[model samples]
Target: MRGTWLRSAWVMALSVLIVASLATVAAAEVTTIRWLYPGGEQPVSQQTWKSQIERFAKVHPEIKVEVIDVPWDLAHDRIVNMVMAGDGPDLIQMGSRWIPEFAEMGALMPLDQYFGKEKMSLYYPGLVKTVTYKGKLYALPRAYSTQALIYRTDLIKNPPKTWDEVVTISKKIQSEHPGMYGLGIGGANHVSTLSQYFTILYTYGGRVFDEQGRLQLDSPEAVAALKRYVDFYRKDKIVPNPLEYNREQLPELFSAGRIAMFVSGPWGGRALGLPPDNDRIPYASAPVPAGPAGTATELVSDSTGIWAGTRNLKAALTFLDFITSPEEQVQRDLIGGLVPQGPTMATRPEFTKNPFFKTFIDMAPHGVPQPQPALWEPFQEVIVNMVQSATLGMVTPEQAVKQAVQELRAKGLVPAEKK
Candidate 1:
C-alpha cells in the first residue's frame, strides 16, 4: 500500500511539470505574419488573396499579417536576394521548381512536424510531395495543374487514346482542313516545352538519373521517349515550325480555329469556352495518354511555405491554415480556374459533372510533381536544347539523351552518388 501511494504521487508530479513547461513555452511565443508574393497588376491569385485579407485578420486579430506583393517578372530574383540577406518573409509562395533550391539552402521550414500525416490527408498527395524534401513536408500547394489534352470536341468525336491514334487523327484532320494542324506544339524554348518532353520521358521509365544518382538520360527508355516526340515532327508532319512556336500564342491559335487539339490547362477551358461573354467554344479535356507501363501526368503548381528564419512561426502557420481553410478554398475554382487540392474538397461529385473539368478531375490522382532539384532552373535550358535538337532531327533520340546527361554532369547540377 505504501509503495502504491508513492508511485501515484510521482506520476502526478511529472504530469504537473509537463503542463507547467508547456505553459511557459506558450507564454514565450509571439504572434505576427509576414508574407511575400510575386506581384502583378491583375493576377487572379493576388485578387483572391487580397479579398480574404480582412477575413484572415478577423480570425487571428492577435497576429498581424504584413503582405507584400512585389513587382512582376523580377519577383523571383527579389525573393532570392531577400533570403540571401537574411530578410526572408515569414511565409512565401514558391513555384514548383524553386522548392528544391530553397529546401537545399535550408530557407524553408518543414511543416510535417506541426501538421502530421492525418492533417496532411487534407491535400492532394502528389502536390504535397512536390514541396516535400527528404520525406519532410516543406510547403503546401495552393494551386495545381495536371497535364491534360485539350481538344476541339467537334474535331475528335472519339478522342485519341494513343500516340498512333493522335497521328492518324492529325493527318486526317489536316488533310481535310488546311492551315489547321490537328495538334499544335507550342514549341518555343521554355519550361512548357521541357515539361511536355519530360511527360514522355517519365512515361517511358526514364528519369534524369538512376537509383544510384548517376546520369541515366542515355538509357533505352530515354531514347524511346525522345524518338516518340521526334517522330511527331519528322513523320507526323503536324507541328509546323516548332522552333518558332510559342505556347502562350498557341491558345490564340486554338481560339482562332487553327488547331484541333493541344495540351493546355483548365484555365484554357474557361478561356476557350468564354472568349467574350460566353461565346462558348466546344471543347473537352482528358489525361495525357498512357505509355506502356502507366500514365504519368505532371502537376505544375505554386505552393506556400513558412520561411525558416521567421520569428513569428506560429502566427505564420495560423495564417497558412486560415488561408487554406474551407472558407477561403470555397472560391478556389470560381476565382482561379484551378482544380481542388484536397480530397475533402476535390472529390465533390458536383465538380465531376462539370463536363469541362471531368477528365482533369479524374486525372488528379496520377499527377507527378514537377521534378524538384537544387538549382534546377539554370539547367533547364540545356534540357530544352536537347529536345529541340531531337525534334529538328539534328541528333538521334539516344544521342540527344546522351548529350543532355553529359551536360548535366558537367554543369554539376546533378549530385554525385554517395559511395
Candidate 2:
C-alpha cells in the first residue's frame, strides 16, 4: 500500500511539473509584430531596416518586430490581399495616397488616441495633410520627396527657370548632343506617371478638388493643364517613347546619360551612383521649371501605419512613434536618400551644406501634397489613362478631359455639373 501511494505521488508530481513547464513556455513567448516594410527584397534596404528593428528591440525587449520587405511594385496589391484575408501585418509602409483607400476599407487604425494634434507638429504640414482622413490621423509620415529637375550641367550652361526655357534648352541640348534625348518623360499606367503629370498640373494652377472636396477635373484650369502636359510629347518631340517609360525608367535614363533633363526625387542620386551633394557627375538638380502660375511640384511621402485589425495596437503605436522621432527619421532619411520631413532635420547642416539637398529642402515649404481623392487608387487609373490617350493621339486633350469628367461622374465620384 505504501508502494502504491509512492507511485501515485510521483505521477502527480510529474504532472504538476509538466503543467508548470507549459506555463513557463507561454510566459517566455514574446509578442511579435510583423512589419511590412517597403524595402522590396533589396539586400541593402532590408539590412538597414533590420538594423533599425534590432535597435527598436533593444529598447522594447517585450515586443519583437519581424520585418517583411515588400517590394514597391507588389506592395499595394499584396497589402490589399493580406487585409482582405483579415491577417494583415501589424504595421505597413504606406504611400500618402494610400491612406484614403485603406481608411475607407477600415484597414488602418486611427492614431489620434496615441498621437494627438500636438504630435502632428513633428512633421511638415503637407505630410500631415496626407495622413489625415475624415479628421482622423491614420499614419505618420517618415520620408517625403518633392520633384526636382535634374539636368546635365555640361549640356546646358544655364538651367531653365521657366517652362519655355526648359523646352528651348532641351531642344538645344538634343540638337547639339547626338544620341541623347532632350527630356526623360513617362506616360505609362503607373503611379509615377500620374505624379509626373501632377507637378505640371499644379504648376498650371489646376486642383483636383475645391474646398468642398468636389472633383474639378473638367475645370478650365485642369483642361488647360492637361493640354500643356500632352504637348510635351505630341508637339515638343522632346521625350522619346514617353508612352513606354515609368518613374523608375526616367532615373535610369538620366544616370545612363541618355537624357539631358529628368525630373525626379532626391533619391534619384541612388541611380546616379553618387551622393546628393557630390558633383562628380555632370548632373545637377534644380527646382522643376515654374509654370505661369508659380512653382509647383508633387510631394510624395511614404508613411508607416498600423493595421486596425492587429491586437497589438499599443505595441504597434510604440514602434510607430519611435521610428518617426527626429533621430530615427534623420537616420532613415540619410540612409534612404529621402528628404527630411521636419525643419530641424531639413535644416541640418549636412543637408543645408549640399546644394542638391538644399534645393529640395528649400522647396519643401512650398510643395503640395498629391491629390487625396477618396477614390485615389482608381482615380490614378483614370488620370493615367486620360494622359496616355492624349499623348498617344487617341483623343484630343479636351476630349480626354471631358471623358475623364464623365467617368468620374459615372463612378459617383463627382457631380455631373458645376454646383
Candidate 3:
C-alpha cells in the first residue's frame, strides 16, 4: 500500500511540472504592453478604459495591456523624463500639440507607414494635421473639442450672432438679473485662458504666426481682440471676477445661475448635468459670436501614440488600431464628453441627434488649431500672462500684446523674418 501511494504522488508531481511549463510558455507567447494614460485617474474614466482593454483582450488574447493612470498636469514632464531615460511606456496619450515636440525628440514612432491614406482619411484633416510633424504622422486623435457660446435659454431667447450683440445682450441680462453676470470669462493663469483668448483672437482674424512664421500678437487684429475680451470685464462689467475663474469653472457657475452665458466645448452641457433632451439648467448652444473677420473657435485634440522605445511595436499598433476604431472612438467620445474626431463619428446618432453636439460639429470647419511651438509651456505662459495682465488693469491690451510678442521673440520662439 505504501509503494502504491508513492507512485501516485510521483505521477501528480510530473503532471504539475508539465502544466507549469505550458503556463510559462503561454505567458512567454503573450506580449505585454504598457500604456501611460493621462486624465484617466477619475473613477469613471478608469472604468471605461478598463472595459476597453477587456474588450481588446477578448479579441487579441495573445496581448496584455497595462494602463498607468497619470494626472493631466504631470503627464507632459513624466513622458519626457521616461522617454529620455529609455524606459517609456509602449503607448502614450498626448495632447496633439505635444506630438511635434515629441516627434522632434525622436521619442514617438512615425505612424504613416502603418496607417495608409485611406485609414488616415478616417480622421478630420485638420486633426490629422495636428498629429503630423514634418510630413510624418505621429499619433491618432482620440479626443477633439471646439468652443461654442453656451447661454441660458431663459435669459436670452436668441443667441448672440456678433461680438457687439454679445456685449449688448450681456448688458441687458445683467441689468435684469442682479447678482448674476451676463457672461463668464476666464483670465486665470491656465491653458484655458489661452484657449479663450485664442478663440477671440482667431475670430478677429489674428494669427499667432503668419505664413512666414513671424509673431503677430501685436498686430492690430490681435490687439483689438484682446481689448474686446478685457472690455467684457473692465468696461462692460457684464462678467464677474474673471481673474478667479477658468474655463472649467464657468460651466458650474452657469449651472448655478451665476452666469448667463459662457463659451465652452460640447462637454459644457454634460458638465452641467444636462441630458440630450432634459436639461437641469435651461441652456442652448450656438456658434461663437462672430467678429469683424468671421466666426472662429479654438480646435483642440488629444491623441494616442506609440512610444519609440517600445519593444512590442506590433502589439502597440494593433492596440492603437483597435482603440481608434469608429465604434471604439464613439464609445470613448460619449463617455468622455468629447466631440467626434471625424466625419464618420459625426454621422452617428449620438452626435447628430443632439442639438448641442450638432452645433459644435457645424463649427468644426471654422476651427483653428492651437499654435505648435517647440515647447508649448513657455509659449502658453506668455499668452496667459498677456490676457491676465490686460484683464487685471495691469496694462492696456496693446501694451500687453506688445510685451507678449517681445517675450516670444526674446525666447527665439518666433522664426526670423524672411530676408
Candidate 4:
C-alpha cells in the first residue's frame, strides 16, 4: 500500500511538470511583431495588405504580426505621439520623405548593418538617397511612383517630348476638341500641386535648396520655372480654371476623356478604368517633358523601417527581408498597384507585362526625390502658397518668388541677410 501511494504521487508530479514544460515551449515559440501601415484602414488596401501578411505568416509560422492601420493624414502625427509615449510598433510603413524627419529624431534603426551599402545599389539612386540621412540608411523601399505625361493615345498620335511640345500639342488639342483642355493644371493649396510643379522646376534647373542648404526661392532658375508654369495658366490658356482646381480633379477629368494630356503617376491608368496592361488601353504614358536644362520628374516612394526601440530587431529584419525579396515584392506590387523598387523585380516578366509600368521604370533612373528637410512640410507650404499666388494673379511670378524668399527667411528656413 505504501509503494502504490508513492508511485501515484510520482506520476502526478511528472504529469504537472510535462504540462508546464509544454506551456513554456509554446510561449517561447511565438514572437509577435507590431506593424503599422497608413493604408490599413481602407477596405481594399487593408484586405490586400493583410493577405500579404498572411503570406508572410505562412512562410514563418513562428512569427505573429499584429497590424495597425492608420489614415495617411493622421499617420505622421500618430506615429510621433506613439513614439513619444514609448509605445511604437516594431515596424512601420512610412513615406520616404518622412524618413528624414523620423531618422533625424533617432527613432528609426540604422539599417546598414542589416541591408548593407552593397544592397543599396539594387534600388534607384534617387530612392536610396531619400531614405538616407547623415550617411545612414534608415529604411527599405517597398514601392515607388514617378510622374509622367499620361495622354489619350487615340487623340495624340505622337507624344510630346519637350515642354514647348506640351504647349503646342495642348493648344492644338484645345482648338480641335471643344470643351477639352490640353493640359491639366491645379493651383489649390494642396501638397500635390507642389509635386506637379516640381517637374517643371527641376526641368528648368531649379531647386528648393542649393547645396549649402540655403533656400533658393528667389534664384534666377526658380523665378524662370515659376514664370513658365504661370504662363501655362495665364498666358497659354490651355488649362481650364487652373486657379480653382486641385490634384484629384485632373485625374478624374482625364479618365472621362475631358482632357487630352496631363502628367501623373501609373495610378492614373487605373483611375481611367483601364486594364494594367497599357497595350490594351487607349491611353499611354511618356516621360515628363524636358526643358532647357534636362528631363526630370518627382519620384514618390513608400518604405518599411524597423523601429529603433524594438526588442525584436532580428526577427523584424527577417520579416523585412521576406517582404522585400524579389518574388514577394512582385506579389506586393500586384496587390498595391505600385511600381517595383529594384531592377530584379522591375525586369521580371510580371512587371514587364504591364506596359504602362515601363514609362515609370524608365523615368525612375532620371527621377528626382522630393526635398526631405526636417522642416519639409513648411517648406512645401511655401511652394504651395507661391504657386497659388502666381496662378491666381495675386502676385506676379517674380513677386511670388521674392515673397516666398521672405516667408522662408522669416520662418528661419533660409539664411537671413547679414545686418
Best by lDDT: 3
Residue pairs in collision within model 4: none
lDDT of 1 by residue, 1-419 (tens): 99999999999999999999988876555365778876534577678877777887676567777778876456678788998899999998867678767887888988887877776777787777777766678887777776678877777788878767788889999999888888877557776887677777766777775433456676888889888888877887877666777565667778888888777667767665453223344777767766764666777878789989988877888888887775477576657777777777766765665777767777777776666544666668778888899887889878888888777767776644322
Which stretches in model 4 have alpha-carbon errors above 4 Å? 1-21, 210-212, 276-281, 414-419
Alpha-carbon error at 50 in model 4, in Å? Answer: 1.4
lDDT of 3 by residue, 1-419 (tens): 99999999999999999999999999999999999999889876797799999999999999999998999999999999999999999999988878867887889998888999888878888788778776788999888999899988877899999989988998898788888888998888878988899999999999897544557676999999999999998998889888899999998898788999999998888888776345556888999999998999988998999999899999999999999998998998888878888898899998897887799998899988777765688888888889989888999999999999888877766644312
Model 4, span 38-112: residue lDDT tens? 867887677767887889889898898888989887888888888888888999898877886787677899998
Q: Write the per-residue lDDT of candidate 2 for residues 260-332, one digit (tens) a residue.
A: 8888888775677765444544767888888877878878888889998998887888888888888888888
lDDT agreement with native, every candidate: 0.74, 0.81, 0.87, 0.80
Per-residue error (Å), model 1, residue 56: 0.7
User: Sorted on TM-score, highest at the top, how do the candidates line up?
Assistant: 3, 2, 4, 1
Off by over 4 Å in 3: 1-7, 210-213, 276-280, 415-419
Model 2, position 275, has a per-residue lDDT of: 56
TM-score of 3: 0.95
lDDT computed for candidate 2: 0.81
